[model samples]
Target: MHVSEHIIDIRYAETDQMGVVYHANYVIWLELGRTKLIEDLGLSYIQMEQDGIVSPVLDLQVTYRKAMRYGEKAIVKTWIEAVNPLRVVYGYEILNEKGELCITASTTNILVKKDTFRPVSFKKLYPDWYEIYVREQKNENIN
Candidate 1:
């Protein structure tokens, strides 16, 4: 799959009193990776929203592995895990500077109408974007 890489410069404010990263910050990093992936594909989430389709996370799964400390650099690797008419799942791994896994996660989202909050199909509303999603999930040999 076409994985997107995003580097995060951990800050003291992102950590707990023990210097370990706060759990909620990992979720922010996931979004940064997702945004990078969309940008890499020459697409804009703003544009998608402008089209009256809003993507909302339906579920989130996170597993914390090794603890990440403040001042350490984090590399978030993300890929398109799956995509269907209503849902898209993005997978992620947050690794420390030494490439040790710190966290792994996935976010499942659905496209919905901004006005009504009714679920919409990206495959139907945004065919071109849907095709790109399909193509992005095809690199099995990379991992």
Candidate 2:
């Protein structure tokens, strides 16, 4: 599978009043991981936008397993879970410095026309990129 790892150093500002990383910060980390994954695959979100295609999140699911505090680092492991003509599902695992999993999540994104905001099939618009995702999804399943 095409897996990408992104490391995030928990900042003081990301912590809550109790000193644990805020719940919402995980969402940002997810985005970071996703961005890294896309870049690792040799694609650019900026290029997608410049081409008048936008991918918006259709669904998000996150499960917090362990608490992480500031001064620690988080390793986000991301990969493609599934991909089709219209949607791509990305999976993630956030692990603490000690390598314990702190969160598990997935996000589904749909591509659309930037101007009209109408849904579009990624396979039709970007067949090469779509094929890469399909290959990754197959590798993920095999693992």
Worst-scoring 10-residue span by lDDT in model 1: 134-143
Where does model 1 exceed 4 Å of error? 138-143
The CA lDDT of each predicted structure is 0.89, 0.92
How many clashes show up per model? 1, 0
Off by over 4 Å in 2: 138-143
What does candidate 1's lDDT look like per residue over 26-127, in tens digits?
A: 999999999999998888999988989898898999999999998899999998988876778889999999999989999988999999999987889989
Error of 1 at 139 (Å): 9.1
Please give each candidate's TM-score. 0.94, 0.94
